[model samples]
Target: MTTTGLLGAALLAGLNVLPVQAAAAPSLPRDGGPAAEVLARQEVLDRLADEITRVPEHERSLVAGYAGHTVDPRHGHLDLYWHGRLPDHVTKVLAAAPTGVTAAVHEASYTLRELRAGRDRLVGAVVRGEAGAVWTSAGPLVDGSALAVGYTPDGGGRHGVATAGEVSARAAAVAGVPVTAVTAAASTAASTRHSDASPWSAGAELTTPGNGWCTSGFGGWRGTTAVLLTASHCGTSGTYRTGAGAVVGTATDSDTGLDTTVIDVNGTPSGKYFDGGWDNGSGYAKRVVGAGRNNVGDLVCASGAMSGIHCSLRITATDVAAEVNGQWRTDLDTATRTDDSTVAVAKGDSGGPVVASVNGGADMQARGIISAGTGNPVVCGSVAAPTTCWDSLRFVPIAPIVSKFGLSLA
Candidate 1:
C-alpha cells in the first residue's frame, strides 16, 4: 500500500477513531481563458445544484446516478462516503467493518421549480444527492449540526471548508447522513495562489520512471516552500520517498478519514511539476487550481497502480456527499462519473493524484487524490446501457484537508 493507504489502513486496523470524507472531482469555459472557464463551469454547476434541490428524492437519485459520474472511482481507495451510500451500495465500498466514516450532501444546486422553470437546475441536480428542501434568494444556508465543517458551496462563490458552526440547517438537512458530530476538516480559503496556474497536462508516452503511476492535486505553499501535492495516502505513510524507496520527508499532517495527505518532500525525487492541484473540467484542460467548486463537462483523471479502474472520470453532481472516512467533511461535491473510460486505478492507486489536463504539458496538475464514491464504475447519461458500470468513487481536495490538520506544505 502507498504510505497514505498504509496509514489509514493501519489506523483502522488499530481501531482508533478519526473523521473521514474523500471522493470528489470537475467544470467549464472562457476568456483569460482557463480561469474564466473555471468560473463559468462553477456557474453551470451552481445552476445544476439549484435544480437538483427541487427534484424529489427518487428523481434526485436518478439524476444523481448520471451526475454521479464525477464522484465515483478512486485509485487511492479513500471514498469518504464509501460506507454511507444508500445502504445497499455502502457494503460495496466499505469493509465488513469500517473505521471513521460519514458522507451526505449539504447543498443542492437546484430546486424542482427551477428545473421546471428552465432546466437550469440540471447543473446542480446533476451533482446533488437530494433535491433542496427550501429556498431563498441567495440560496439557503445549511444548518451547522448537519455538516462536517458546516459548509455550503452549491451556489456561486464556493469557499474552502466551512467553519465548525458555519453550516446552515437547510444544507445539513440535505445531507444523507446524520449531522450530530464532526471531526476537524478543511477550512482554508481554497482560493489561494493557485487561481492562475498552468495546465500541467500529460500524454501516454511521457511516463516518467521514478514518479510511479501517481496522479496530482492542488499545489500549495507551506510557509515559503512550494511542495508538490497529492493525497497523504499516496506517499509512504511515514514520510516522503523516491522511486528508489529512499526516505525523503514526511507527510505534513494527513486526515485519514478525509483521505488527504501532504508529503513535505522538501527533498524527495524532486522535479518541477508545479506544487498543487489542477482540477478543471473539459475544454482547454487548464491547470488544476481551486477547490470546493467544480462543475459539469469537466474532464478529470487519476493515476495509480494499473490494477484498479484507473481512468478519466467525467464530472457529475448527483447523489453526492462530502464527508471523510464516513464523517461529514468539506464542501466539494463527493463525485461520481461514468467509469467506461480506459482509466483503471488499483491498490497502489490510493493517494495517487488526479490531474486536470489542459493544453497538455510534460506532466499533470495535482487536483484531487484517488478516492471512492458510491456507484461501481459510475454509470452516467444512461444507467440502462447494457454496459453500465459502478460509480462509487471519491477524491479528496488538498486545501481543506490540509487546513483541518493545521499543517503546511512547507
Candidate 2:
C-alpha cells in the first residue's frame, strides 16, 4: 500500500473508531414541540448508535456486513445500513435501545469496508496522476450509496475539457463504486493570533517563531512528558510562544498526513480551553473531559484565536480526503454552520479545539482540531487585522491523533 493508503488504514483502525457510551440519560426540555424532542433524543441515540457499531479486536469480521450509519438528530432516529446478515452484537443493541429512540435498518448495496477500498483505489489513482488531474478530493459517502468526488468546473486547473459527469464516470470506473460529483472549493489553513498567560490553555494564540501564528489545541501527556497539540502546518519545528511573548513549548514531532504536531511544554499545560470571543482575554474556560468521534448530524463547536466559539455547526461528512496547502490529507471531516449567515471557522483558528457539549454543556468532549476553511469566505469583524472566515470548515479528528502519538488526556 502507498503511504497515504497506509495512513488511512491506520486511522480507520484507530481508537476513535470505537464509540464512547453515554453515561447518563438525556435531559429533555420541560416544555417543547417535536423539534425540541428530536434534539433531546439525539443525546442517547448517539451513544446507542456507537454501541451497535463497536467491534472487538478479535471479532473484526463483525464489520463485514456493516456499511455506514447516519444519526438523524433532527428526525429522532438512527439509520444503519448493512449488507447480508446483521452482526449478532448489532442486533442485540438495536433491540435494547431506549424507549423513545428508534433504529431504522436499511439494506445496502455495498459494505463500508468495500466502499473504503474503492475510495482508496480512487485516491491512489489520483496520486499517481493516472485518474486525470481533475479531482481535488474524494471519499465514501455516509449513505453508503456512492463515492463523493470533488471537482471544479475548470477541472481543478488541469483537465478543463472534462465535464463533471465525465469526471464522475471516470472516477467511478477507478473506484468500482457509484460516484457523485460535487463542486470543489479551494481550502486554506486557518492560522493567525490570540494572547494568554502561563499554564497555557487550548484555543489560545501561539506565535510560531517566524512562521506567523496558530491556535493551541488540546493538552495531553506524551508518555511522562507534558505536551500541547497544534497544527503541523503552522511550523513543523519551532519555539512556539504565546501572544504575550511567553515561551509555550517547542515542536518535538509532527504527522504531516494528520496535520498534527506535539509540543514539549516549557510551562504547565492545562486541560481547559478558552471558550469566549476573540477579545475575551481568556476569561472563559471549558474542561475537556474526554475525546469522541463525530457522526453526521451531530452538533459541534469550534474555538479559534481568530473566531472564538461557534457551536451551531453540524457534521456534514466524515472520513473525507482533501488537498490542503499542496498536500493530500486523508481522513478529514467537514462541518457547516446550521445558520448559513454565521461564520463557522476563520483564518488563525487552525489547531484550535473542535468539541461537543457534554455534562449538560458544562464540559466538552474532544472531537477534532480545526484544519482548514472551505466554501465561501466571510468578513472577520472581531479583529483589527484583515482575515477571512468560512461558512464551512474541515477538521482532523482528535482520537487518531491521541492514539497515534500514544498520548493521554491530562
lDDT of 2 by residue, 1-410 (tens): 01112123333233122232333443321111123344455566678767876632112224777766778655556767777777667766766666556556776777777777777787787678783657777877766778888877776667466778898898888889999887867677887335676676788888886657789999988888889999988988979988778888899999998999999997667788887677765357878888876777777788888777777678888778788877888888888887754588888889999987655455678888999998778766565257888988999988789878998976
Best by TM-score: 2
Q: List model 1 lDDT by residue over 353-410, tens digit each.
A: 4555433222334445555433333322211112222343455654355566553432
Please give the range of 10 consecutive residues that has the lowest summed lDDT in model 2: 27-36
**CA lDDT of each prediction against the hidden true structure:** 0.33, 0.74
Worst 10 residues of 1 by lDDT: 187-196
Count of backbone clashes, every candidate in sequence: 128, 3
TM-score against truth, every candidate: 0.38, 0.87
lDDT of 1 at 385: 14
RMSD of candidate 2 to true structure, Å: 7.9
For model 2, the stretches where C-alpha displacement exceeds 4 angstroms are: 1-40, 55-62
